[model samples]
Target: MHIEDHPVLGKQLQAPVKFYFNGQEYKAYKQQTVAAALIANGIKKFGLSRKLVQSRGLFCSRGRCCSCYMTVNGEDHVRTCMTRIDEGMIVSPNLEDPVIRSDRDGD
Candidate 1:
């Protein structure tokens, strides 16, 4: 099955919104959350394990959960699931470091 037109989100979406991940450009809809936008761009894992350094990504849809949390605009620990995106926003990894593993690649 496929979505011909979304009933809740509407068929005609707003202008394509642009944001950056690891300094790379990408587009998303104006109505989408940061997490949604990232997911649309094929981002599977958005975070790393606190200790083990395993990959992490969104599990819960609501902001009450910290699963989608990441750094936005250089601020630490912002919830991507709660933040609605705007044009030309910049998103980057927020790893706790003194050391970055080879997995420091973008989502």
Candidate 2:
């Protein structure tokens, strides 16, 4: 879902970088976001919801929405849309919602 040739920007010049999605090797541009890269690879479903288990993907390409949350590089609850792709990076679905901690709970 990307413009191959922009009327103004023209052709893309970014080199491809290797990355892993749930243990499966995939390719993406160096400057592309994890979500955009995944979408470019024809991956529509990012993960399932915690309560309903409904499929979720890039609803708001912007980082304001949480629909694109996933695990990246051994970290939980990463917003894939806002994360840039890096070589050898690992991305995975957060199947279950992570526990949220509040400062008052520890006090």
Candidate 3:
């Protein structure tokens, strides 16, 4: 779903790069963010809500919203919208419990 040519911006000139998401391979251009790549690949659901367990996707493309949080490499809570796609970079959905734990109760 990538825009091959923008009326104002013209054609994309960046070279394509490969990255993995949820063990699946996808292509993206250099300097493109992970969220952008995922969206381009038709991936709308990024994570789920804690309380209601509702499906969450890219709400704010900016880094302000936490809706786009995902796991990258071995790190959790990585903002996909702010993370640039790198060659061979591994990305996965955040599988950890989304519940906010209280410090008083140790899980």
Candidate 4:
């Protein structure tokens, strides 16, 4: 949940933006991240682990962990906590295993 009653940042003036999650439209602040917006809307689960199939959500909230990884605009393994919300953007949980590119493979 967002800190609407923050002792320091109470109800700051942030531009509103619209985005889609799993095809459903959602409203978010222009400066907010996808994870933050989702949490503000009471969405607890972010994505499921590819191996264990367990639900995961924002953990570190600092882009240090994979707990916030999701799909954004057809891109996989997106760190939602680091990605700022944009107008008309599409976001979805990463349902499958993330494809890791190895440096051994020629780029």
Q: Point to the candidate with the largest TM-score.
A: 3
Per-residue CA lDDT of candidate 3, range 21-57, in tens? 8889999888789899999999988887777878887
- Point out the higher-scoring one by lDDT: 1 or 3: 3
Write candidate 4's Cα lDDT for 1-107 as tens digits: 55655688788736888889888998878889889988877886888997899999999989999799999987889999999989999998878775567554554
Off by over 4 Å in 3: 98-107
Provide the lDDT at 54 for model 3.
82
- In angstroms, the error of model 4 at 84 is 0.5
Clashing pairs in 3: none
Residue range 48-69, candidate 1, lDDT tens digits: 7688887878888787768776
Q: Please report, in order, the local distance difference test score of every candidate based on alpha carbons.
A: 0.76, 0.86, 0.84, 0.85
- What's the ranking of the predictions by TM-score, best on top? 3, 2, 4, 1
Give the worst 10-residue stretch by lDDT in candidate 2: 98-107
Global lDDT for candidate 3?
Answer: 0.84
Clashes of 1: 0
With a 3 Å backbone cut-off (N, CA, C), the pairs that clash in candidate 4 are none
Worst 10 residues of 3 by lDDT: 96-105
Runs off by more than 4 Å, candidate 1: 1-4, 7-9, 97-107
The CA lDDT at 107 in model 3 is 53
When 1 and 4 are scored with lDDT, the better candidate is 4
Q: How far is each candidate from the true structure, as Cα RMSD in Å?
A: 7.1, 3.7, 4.3, 3.6
